[model samples]
Target chain A: MFPGPSAKCARLGHFLFLRSLTTEATCAVTRTPTLPVKQATRPQKSDKTSISTAIVLNRAPILTRSSTPFETAYYSYQARIRRALHNPFPYDFYFKQGTLIETRFNLEERKRERLAFGPAFLSKEDVSEEKRAADIAAVEQLAQQEGEGEVLMPRTHPSDTSGDVRSLDRKGQRNLYLLLHVLENGKETWRFPLGKVEKGQFLHQAAQKDLYAECGDEMDTWVVGKAPIGVYKPRQTSAEAQQASEIVFLFKAHIMAGQVKPQGDHIEDFAWLTKEEIKMRVHSHYWDGIKDILSDH
Target chain B: MSMQVASQAARHSLTRFQRAPKITRKLRRHPKTGLPTPHVKIVTREFAPSRLEEHYHTTLKDDLMYMTYKHEIGERPPPRQIRMTFDPEDPYSKYRHNAPVGGSQFHKKPAPSSSPDNVVRLEKIQLHTMVKEAVANKSQLLSAIMQMKALTGETFQGGGHHAVEGIQIVRAKKSVGGWIRPNVPVGVKVDLKGQAMYDFLGTLVEFVLPRLRDFNGIILPPQSSSIKTPSSVSGVVSFGLPPSALVFFPQIEVNVDAYPKLAGMHIHFVTNAIGVGAQDRARALVSGFQIPFLRR
Candidate 1:
């Protein structure tokens, strides 16, 4: 319905017409939306020229085209790292490719058919311990061959890292971030879900709201006013704030889950690790600080 | 009328009969008896924030601007990405191009599978185009852009009074573009010394960049799963200095975070050049200009 080539009238008359198709009426472009629009004044021939322009916000939605990017190296790092860092109960096993796209080899066509990114982050329950471990191993093996170096993760992969598949939602986009760190104890582990800024809300409130949203069952640790922090990357920008700047504080909070219950299923099937296990099992640089986080307590 | 109706009915019947599935002679039938086959099965496919993602500003501010890195590497499409190094010393040194063109000898992956590749490829192309355009405009200089907008723009309707001063600052920065103005670089250290300009600059860098980091790219974070059946914990990802590693100076770590000394954050507005053609060059051209405030 949106900006489709077929008009509404043509759509309604599809089967009624004798010819399989009808032609669209001519339309004229009255105006155009140019970007980083320049000023509407004459250009001066002076050696040093100054042009006046207008900066308008690109109010269009983001469109994505990628298939199963999570299968890529970055998400491989994400899936393994999160599970290792926080878990209520130690995982007994992990199965890889439980969510693999089941397809037979097509000799005529040599490529593998694919599935969605959801299966990677959403189906942790179905994967057997062995499979998850194997996939982690596979990813680690690839990382190992390249050699480890401290590199800041670029801000472009989650959307374009994969080769085949388009994002279902384009331009119309919003995101929920969980700035969580892990907690440690004997037989009991906890997740300290960081708060987030709401759309148009103050960054500080967003963080508190995020904390509360994830604070189900662990409301005891709820508190506002965390220290504001931020860094500049080529792409990071805020939505509520015009320039995507930050003025909110971040806090470090922990939980006492009281028992080894999987109150949050996302937290289930995760393995508990000592400092040694963390250094060994976790592969991504993002989690390089997990041991330090746990060591605090 | 009756005759016409009868003829039409005949035509309909004939059409249905002709359209009926054809038997591959004996293939559709059993050697001894005949029966039709059954049909096949069907398959199909949250926003919660607790996760951070690498962002490509495909759409930003109001979704009008797309921020893709403008590559200086000519003719060749930009790589899917230029790895951002923990070592802030070199930002675009290893921006290798890994974006492949097609599969095998002659065929490309089907369009469905190639969307991401196409987007990455297109974004690289667009980056170059943007650079060319920006370079063309550079003869034009960083043109001052003035924006006309609705004001009291700081408050949200939900009694939230949200301050999008960042956007306001950006818009104002653009407004300055409409008139000639000199830009203050982001990395060069300057004495803020109680200037309103410096105060605004400090707020902009301190509050905006980290959150904006993930959404500025072609990628976005995976949705947070259902809480009750939280199938998988949201993946945790971070890229910062390894605390144990000895740092030659604290400034490097702070700069690693894109903090400490960076300015013109108010001017880091990008045009829609992501996942499109010839955009990388435009951004790369902009990248050539150092932010006076940000230091290595």
Candidate 2:
């Protein structure tokens, strides 16, 4: 079980305290104009002030990032130092003497030690050549009986090789964000799923609703918090200046299950892209606003 | 002088078959304390990469920051002055310790502003267990001490660090009517940090919890419970493991019969988070490590 919905409500209360403060400041700024002018223009200005909620639906890294060559080398060096300086292993406590398991462990340990310190570091083993061969064979047989050897799944997914940006499984080691290719101004533009906040709707609630409305209700998603992670304002042209000045509040949400099914014709296509890929597809101004909110890895 | 010269002359005329005398070196010691010369201190550090540590950096840090962030438009208003400080000009107060007018309102303190550096993370894990029988006979504490040592693999001041207080003896703080006496050893405790902390956590999650019967995750307090309690602000999440669950630990599972009695431990996860709602943040961090929580 997780923190109940009430916990979110309590957090929303905290966010409201700051929201009230900001609202008060804005209210004061609007009151600076002449009383008659303010009263007459208030309704028109309110109508022109557009607030929208956008969901930066994210898929967290499913796999650990592979270490760089330098990191691997450093780690191996540190491991060798640890091995050289470690306390003696209690063989009697862990394994019975003259047992096959103990013999196998010794063989494995010797191989590891030789790898760390080089072959010449150890003296010749007292055991005869035939006995050593027999021990190795017995260990191999035991390993087979226990089904010890199994190939691990490759680090890179099949979708990655195929360059499938739509597949959620494509980037396992990077934070992939859902970017919708939508018809804006009769042209295709890549952006996060965005929709205007309905009357009396909370920003976070609007974000959740917009995500499901655009991406479909099939996916299980959880919005991160009550407060928006960041905010983005679209550049207004002179022709559109008379229209509403749009403010998009971005809320982060994680998709636990299901794929994006673009609900309608408005959403032309959708791609799960990493931060770098998202930057390439979206407008530079749009990227500048949302880049910091998205994780690099 | 004549005898010494004659011996030197005789030594120069030695036979070719004569063997050379072996040379012996004396042990080096410090002149001041008369102790043997010490070897260079070697302190071992993290030997391998920690999976949980990496997870904290890559995933949990960013998520926690976003979740716990409070949007502040401007500088925070200074904390409310509950009590005025005694003036230094007042000689009466200057000579004595000045206490707050009421009491310290530490529990009411607000959380620090969220930052990347201050994201809630586990600092250390304290595993403590009180053995009742140990009060009766001090030797009864051996089994508990052995259990602690085996569980943590820590010794007093291990890894050449004086700050490392491995397994510690918890003594009774106050005298009880018939049960405990002050300064009497009754319990064992160990504080695990860095690699050891993660290792203990991994074992608990992978080997212990799943096998623990009747556990449906740790139960949360009722929704009406007060969040302003001192424990809530201390940034500690405490839970007790049943004695029967001790066997589930692989270290103890190997030699269950070695100890006469097993003791249940109270594990406290201490985190960097402090101030109001700190326990919740601590719990969030712990749950990130895959320790489950439940609401009843």
Candidate 3:
């Protein structure tokens, strides 16, 4: 049962302005001075109101998106325009004459020129074939020594190829949300990690505690703000409806390092899913409630 | 045999004609100016993908919207009238600039109600440096100007954009009794926008900041510092980099000896955020770019 009006007022005063108040406390305080109009309107419902906090743990993109073919073409065209209009490079300021580095730069510049224009656009050099060949060889040797041709890490992770949903590394260029498959009312359901808000708890604080209680302390996570980003109201059965109407306040959090370790028996499994994947797993009504909150990309 | 010899002679003449080099048309010089006339105005745009720009669109934009969102039940009421305004209709002040009664209390103005379109974003970065020696002799400003040009690689109207004032010489506006004279150049600055801004930010974070010795982070003001200030409302986060740190810039590092003197610079990150506590929001956006901030 809800606390008495006098007790609630004292608790409210103690917590005021230090942390943001819960919806019930906020409504009560706003109306307490005038009249207990909210309590009078819903006498029985006020005592059985149920509130829970959910955490939307997120992983931001790791890699920059690859440009589409059209984008690539546009960039190249712009680059060509830039090259043609660029001012002359001050070679004397940056490079010494007859230095190997300068020689390498000159060779690279000619190659880029050929790519921008064509081989036919370049004037024929006065140097003999052997000298030109020697310069090329020297530059190649320098490049080899400097490890310039080392391969970069591939954009796609191994987990992506294997279709491992649990691995956080699966999607390198998409926002991934953490969703849990939990046993609710003897039925398995996919939802954000949810836990009941204890008495006198701030919603934001409850969100953090709930996340750790379900997801374990292995990961370092930061709740985004004091306010909840969104809310979800679950459909109630006749029996449950008679007991309490449930409300879930969803808070966004970022997982900086480590993976979620589902601690309790209530949480059956967990997956790092993109927005579309989440839609496929969660109920239609639930999706309708939270779809707008999830990022598209 | 006579016919064959005639045919061979004709073929040889045709081959010689084909081998001859043709003369190309030259660009005509303008009659008034003596400069070669080109048919078109050339403008160069973004030539490559901007990583930081993409990161903002993909990640930071969404996170910022969530973090800075203030939930409201209904449309915000019109702001309260703080002071009376001078009537323009008054005969004495009709032509004069009628200032507000309490001056423009811009610093105290409330932030615009949160909405999708008004999310804060960086507008541009301004790099400014003052050359002390330039006050003695104007020629000393050349080194600072050169340094700005080198650091940003911006030339006057370089990309054919008229608004792009690549690097500018800052001249004194008023004469101080003995230290300075009006119209004398004492400093240089460059404004970076678009791809150039992101590129500069990336270079600063990746190369310059990490290498600075004994640097913790851009320090924050004391906890009780007043938020109601012109700078706090203007949404500009300004900081200074010492002259010794100038060499850490990869561009300057390449030819450090070329510069006669290095001057410390003030960098201002100007964002689109406005109103009370705007600097806090701007700081949030900047910190998203991994420029760390430390509290005293």
Clash counts for all predictions? 129, 0, 0
- What overall lDDT, based on C-alpha atoms, would model 2 receive against the true structure? 0.82
Select the stronger candidate by DockQ from 1 and 2.
2
Please, what are the lDDT tens digits per residue for candidate 2 over residues B1-296?
A: 99999875554333111232343555467799796543566566776677778778777887788777765558999877666368656978887777776668878989998887898999999999999999999999998998988899987777766878999999999989998889999999999999989989989989999999888788889899999899999899988898899999999997788779999999999999999999999999899888999999
Ranking by TM-score: 3, 2, 1
Q: TM-score for candidate 2, please give it.
A: 0.83
lDDT of 3 by residue, B1-296 (tens): 99999976654343222232444667678899897765668788888899999889887887788777765667788876655366777888788877778888877888887888888898999999989898998898888887888889998988899999999999899988989888988999999999999999999999999999877888999988998989898889989999999999989998899989899999999999999889999999999999989998
Error of 2 at B112 (Å): 1.9
> How far is each candidate from the true structure, as Cα RMSD in Å?
32.7, 12.1, 10.0
Worst-scoring 10-residue span by lDDT in model 3 chain B? B12-21
Off by over 4 Å in 1: A1-196, A222-225, A229-250, A256-283, A288-297, B1-296
- Candidate 2, superposed: residue stretches over 4 Å from native: A1-47, B1-40, B80-98
> Candidate 1 vs candidate 3: which has greater TM-score?
3
Q: Which candidate should be chosen as best, given lDDT against the real structure?
A: 3
Instruction: Please give the DockQ score of every candidate, comma-separated.
Output: 0.02, 0.14, 0.26
**lDDT of each residue in A176-288, candidate 2, tens digit only:** 89999999778889999999876567678888999989999989999987777877888776456445556788888999999989998888899999999998999999989
Better lDDT candidate (2, 3): 3
**lDDT per model vs. reference:** 0.27, 0.82, 0.84
Compose the digit string of candidate 1's lDDT tens values, residues A135-199. 65665555577695568655454534552112322112332112222433333333334333333
